[model samples]
Target: MKPEFENTPLVKAGKRFEIEIDGHFAFIDYREMGHQIALVHTETDPELAGTGAATAVVEKTLAYIEENGKKLLPFCPYVFAYIKKHPDWKRIVDERFEGYNKL
Candidate 1:
């Protein structure tokens, strides 16, 4: 059975969306550049490895970006991979940066 995470709420703390797990944070760091939000990195505590914390944080960040009608620049490899696996998110990607997907 999958381990059930506590109701760890995702928080938009300044430039990142984060979730607290086992006293550490799992987060996706981002920066707003004009009309685009650049997803720069994702990090999870070593203790939270193998858990779904990273995925959860990414999902939440994507949803937040979508809801705000913002474009995306997925500069982070993990964010790029996640959006590649989930094509629906491609709609929000900035056209200039879409070339990154081909790399």
Candidate 2:
């Protein structure tokens, strides 16, 4: 059975890492550029893949950015691809921020 991840929370693990399921993490790597958080890398376990967990992480990260009035730098390939596919969140993006082409 697919894991129920709709209610999972994005928990910050460190300065440049965050995870969804405690030790069973969906890889996340990011850097803080001034007030913005630049996504370096993000991935979900193969077993948890395609379940929208990564999207949840992005949503939570965006919310965190919004709450802090900061911008987003989606450098992670997965995240970059996600935003590229979902233009609705473009408003939260800081084009002036670095790491855009890094995707």
TM-score of each: 0.85, 0.74
TM-score top scorer: 1
Runs of candidate 2 with Cα error greater than 4 angstroms are 1-3, 98-103
Model 1 per-residue lDDT tens digits across residues 1-103 = 1245445677889988898876888998889988899999999999888788888788878877898999989998998998888888899898889565563
lDDT for position 10 in model 2: 60
- What value of lDDT does candidate 1 attain over all alpha carbons? 0.83
**lDDT score, candidate 2, position 102:** 38
lDDT of 1 at 98: 54
lDDT of 2: 0.69
Q: How well is each residue in 10-82 modelled by candidate 2, as lDDT tens digits?
A: 6777754444564455657778878778888877777666766677777677677777888887767777777
